[model samples]
Target: MKKKMMVGGLLPALVLSTCGLAGAQPVAMDTLTAMEQNPDAGSQMRASTEPVTQESLQEMRRQLEEQLQQAQELQNRLNAQLGSLEKRMKKVEKKSWEPPVEIHGYGRLRWDKHRYEDRNDPNDYKTIWLNLFTKYRINDRWALHSEHEFENNLTTNHGAYEGQGGYNEPGGKKYSRPVLQLYAEGRVGEVNVKAGRYYLQSPYKFTFDDKIDGWQISYGIPTKWGRKANFTLSAGNTYSKIFYGDKENESNYWNEGGDGNLKVVSLIGEIPVAKNTNLAMHYGKIKRRNDRLERKTWSIGFDTKINRDLKFWAGIAKSDSQTLNKSHFLQLQYKEARPDIPGSYDIYIKKYLQRGHSGMTNWFNDDIAEFTHGDYKEENIANNGNDKVFQYSRWGEFNGLRIGVDFVPTRNTKLLINYTFGKMGKCLDKDPGRRYDYSFFRTQWEMYF
Candidate 1:
């Protein structure tokens, strides 16, 4: 019986292999038929008992296809993530304040009192002064600025007696307070271009501090000393003959109608000298600007700082003068404005000379000119129709010296005191003249923010 059962189980496997009817794995069909007759067959069923049907095969194929699709989707997601990470790693960043705008201004207020020695004249007087300025920076290379000045007690009552009615008070008219500067500037390449009415503080600050009406071009190279070596070429109106101390007190050079002779040219330079110091040089020319003044002016000057607290300035210039005659000026200054100190101070001394037709040009200089014709020397200080002192505003054949000090109790406040002494020339007429000795005292107070 055992031999017959073994033969019976082997017959179907051999027949299936011969016919090649099974797919991957051959099934024992004869043995399976024999098992159906046994009572224990149900307990020996395999995990995959049925032969593979078309429906089952299709289901298996569908499952494989889904798994392949899922793997492909996962691979594509990894590739996208890698690309995004590479982009983030390769990118850069930038800054915020590429272009900019700004604003700033400074101003001052002052009082002055002056008198003359050895002259029995009504020359002692009181005065007040004020000025304001504004600046606007439009861009990195462009800017604009404006300045205005107001004054009182600029006129004097020369003809009136004590307690009598005369011209004594200030001419406080709207037009009297003139704009000292109004300008616009921009940089193109290495050169800066500026246009409009502006103040001219030439080398030495000795020859002039007048308002100029026109344009300028400048260039500069920076140095180790913090100051720049710069060059400036400018053209504008200069030196208009008028009395700033008289009733008309004319100072405007721009809108007074064009004078063919009013135009002038200037070349100026600032060169580095030492740490916290610089050297300044200037050359300027003024053409004949009026019917009464058919002449020209050419000037030269230099200024330098010796240390952080010491400086010197000087100039020798000629204007409608005799041969070998020239105008001369010299100044020495000491200053200390420390960042850690609230109290700062400056002391300065100056000598001046205006002879041989140097002319009266620097009207808006640091000091005021004499107002009366009777008190002025031949080189007038206030040149109205009356032979006055505009010519001698700074100096003349007469010896002149001035000393001043500026005291600061805080960052925004200052006090100034100045004294001037002058001696008259020997050749001056005796009629409207007082004496050879002249002197005065002036004081000013200023505040700014």
Candidate 2:
């Protein structure tokens, strides 16, 4: 009887141990002692007890070993997963500390046909331009940008006036070498600043295509109406031969001109006058070192959006010079060409009445104001000149109409076609007979990366 009781107790203890190993509640030591000391407790368990054998004990031991092995395998897998997650987190932290850089630009191919009333044959030429732009972000508050341009003329003969004297070469003008265009730009608080070689767009003093060597500062004005307003000041020397002098001269540097050092200062302001409309004003002063000729220029204009897809702009510019002192323009545009959207297009019409002195440099669209050397002549009224006939070459007087269409066939690709027809004459010429009729046509294709 004693042996049977002992086996019964041992069997219960083994069952409890197995349950504990399988993550169940463990039997307390006091409960085990009570079961052993109390006769009633023994009697309660006696009916449920079974005979204990060596085979049964071996089977329980084997099950416990297998459970322990599974738990160890699970712990190993969890440890490996944690290690992989830690590695990915370290990689993300490294990337957050590095600076960012970007590179992009565009290439253009253009064909031009120019016809003057006095010339017997039209001049046709083709040009190719490649521009490279780079940007580096030093931090959230500061960054740097640079642009380089390469221009090449593909037409060798250049039509009838092939050997005529011109700016770069007698046969044809070409810029085969790369030239640095824009250098740096940054922002400080509410002010934006630019340095090195850059371009400006103003009514009288500068156009969008004119390159200048200098610096610029601009600030935005806060308004209660949530309208846009800004003030800009720029001072620089002309860096291209297109600015008021011999077109053939290699004056692609600072303060380089045919006459002497040429410098310019310009101030511009835009104030919101109405919904989707703004009043624009500009003041510019240009001075030449050798001749001491100082020209003061100013303009007032307004631009407005007639509707969602239509816009209009008109402005008048005046100069203090005796000749070429007045100019005005009106423009209307329908739709807009978006480079990122395929099948996008725009159409525009512009009317211009410009005097030579009114624009210190050529207009942004060269086809609108085509200037030919020795084509228009005026009597020397200044009296300081040695020649009796003053040959006007740069931005000579012209009144014209220009119409253009810009289309995008695919993303980052654009096609442009424009035509200009007008009458051009000597600067400040009052005689209507001296004016000659002219026409210009141009087509351009561009691709961006």
Candidate 3:
């Protein structure tokens, strides 16, 4: 009875395990048919279709065992692989990299030479100028910028100097000097404030500020057209180191130190005329104050791109100086793109009219001041024969003309050639009679990276 009970339970358990509860119980129809066919058949025979054979049962059990073992092994292998992958992912996620900071600067150098046929002097000179710039970004909202420049040139026959190579001779009209610029600037919403020493120049316009060093505040407000427009209002002071006067408190008519303190104010704008085309306008005033003279100057200018191949620019300015009397300027410029080459060429011309006051003309220095003064000015305070030299060159009025061309080969290289023509209404030299006419041509080549 014990063996029989064990057999019955094992058969049902195997069936249930292989299929489900339904497979554990065969239908009564099969049992009844089996019983009808063989009434003596025992419960063992009725439990299933045929008799249970030891080898067949053993083979089925072996297959089931093998499959279970394989499933467990596969699960273990997958878990190991998953753990390794998780470790690799953690390592990758922990790695970090930093952004790099870079510093760069550029300048220009040239070998300038000229051969003049006049007097067979064959004057030759070399020119070289170096400018360095540095920019640093503290963050998205803060930046620092600065530039320093040093330049030198050889000068000869520059008429401004008399008696070749004197101790105080304008130093060949070339000298090395430090131009310092340091500023902190960033955009505050739509307005920007820049404070500290900076170089300022008007675009589409020219201002006395171009020659002076000062600080400025610029605001860049947005316009309604989705285009960017900004106006710059600036004030700065400029003065020449070459001051002339016998005494600090004394003022002279022909001296430079009396009122050379240059002050300037400007309003300039950058506006878009079209997609790739822009318009610029500038209006500004420069004032000079000193013991002897105070001057007021105004300038207005316009610059625009007419098309892809053409550009137009024009400006007019007027000045009233205590020492210079009255001065005026007119300028016109045009640029045409050369389609055949990679470089562009441009040309500009300017005409100037200036009335120099009597005491403002520079004709004699300390050595000749005693002797040449009488010949240079209408009345020499020192009473010297230099007044006679002034009779031929000083016209009481001076006019000048400048014409120039610029060629740009790339973003970093440029070539400029300019000619300045000057005329004096008053004569200080006998050879030119009562009028003086002369021209100076200068060529500059620049490169940077």
Give a tens-digit lDDT track for model 1, residues 1-449: 56445545553455445344323222433443444455355443322243334464355445544544565677699999999987765542111332133333444444454544544763555545556677676765888888876544534422212111233333111122167788998999999999998877676554445678899999999888877799999888753442222212224322222233466677888887777555666666655444333334455656677777888877776654332135677889999544235688889998886442343345324554443222233343454656554332222343578899888887777777898777533222222133357666777666665
How do the candidates rank by TM-score, highest first?
Answer: 2, 1, 3
Best by TM-score: 2
When sorted by lDDT, best at the front, the candidate numbers are: 2, 1, 3
Error of 2 at 345 (Å): 1.1
lDDT, candidate 2, 107-153, per-residue tens: 99999888888778887878787888887876666667777876656
Q: Model 3, residue 334: displacement in angstroms?
A: 5.3
lDDT per residue, candidate 3, 4-28, as tens digits?
A: 6776686546643543333322442
| Off by more than 4 A, model 1 | 1-109, 154-177, 223-226, 242-261, 273-277, 289-308, 323-325, 337-341, 355-360, 363-365, 371-398, 425-435
lDDT of each: 0.56, 0.67, 0.49
Give the winner by lDDT. 2
As a TM-score, model 1 comes out at 0.58
